[model samples]
Target: MTGLDPELADATGKMLTQAVAEVVGDDPPVEVEESVVLGNAAEVLLERSCGAELLVVGSRGHGGFSGALLGSVGQHCVQHARCPVVVVRGSVS
Candidate 1:
């Protein structure tokens, strides 16, 4: 969650988790972590990516050419990730 207020972020995160649980019926419990950041999201994702086994991200973020297969974030992570990276691209059905 990106918010100026940490309290608000925390509340929103909890609410989101609960809502996800409602939609994720019969699935095993999932672990979730929320970070309140005011900086670049790509940087934050990279910083937390040091020892991950796999880094999966969208092929394109909310920027640049809409027809491009990869965005700045995907390119940066693909180049900097310690492990393998997967960039998923799909049409909105």
Candidate 2:
């Protein structure tokens, strides 16, 4: 969970949908579901990872040391997740 305010969370969900659409285009080859949960991000993600084939997470999220190789959440998930974890690092624009 991101712990975002309700208003921001709603906007984030919409943005996530839009981003996925932009990436996959009209007919995505794979199914995708976007959601935002409220709680500790790592713990929530870990819980959901139980039956998942893969768990993808960002190298660093909204707030973190920019120079770090991985953020706390990503690091935690990488260390403890039950499934394969993919840590995607965003390019700096």
Give TM-scores for every candidate, taking all chains together and pairing residue i with residue i. Answer: 0.58, 0.75
lDDT of each: 0.69, 0.82
1-93: candidate 1 lDDT, tens digit per residue = 444687877776788678556645547465534344566867877887787666767775444665466888788888887778878775566
Residue-level error in angstroms, candidate 1, position 64 = 13
Residues 1-93, candidate 2, lDDT per residue (tens digit)? Answer: 345687888888889889878877879887765677888888989999998888888885455565477888888999999999988877777
Give, for candidate 1, the lowest lDDT window spanning 10 residues: 28-37
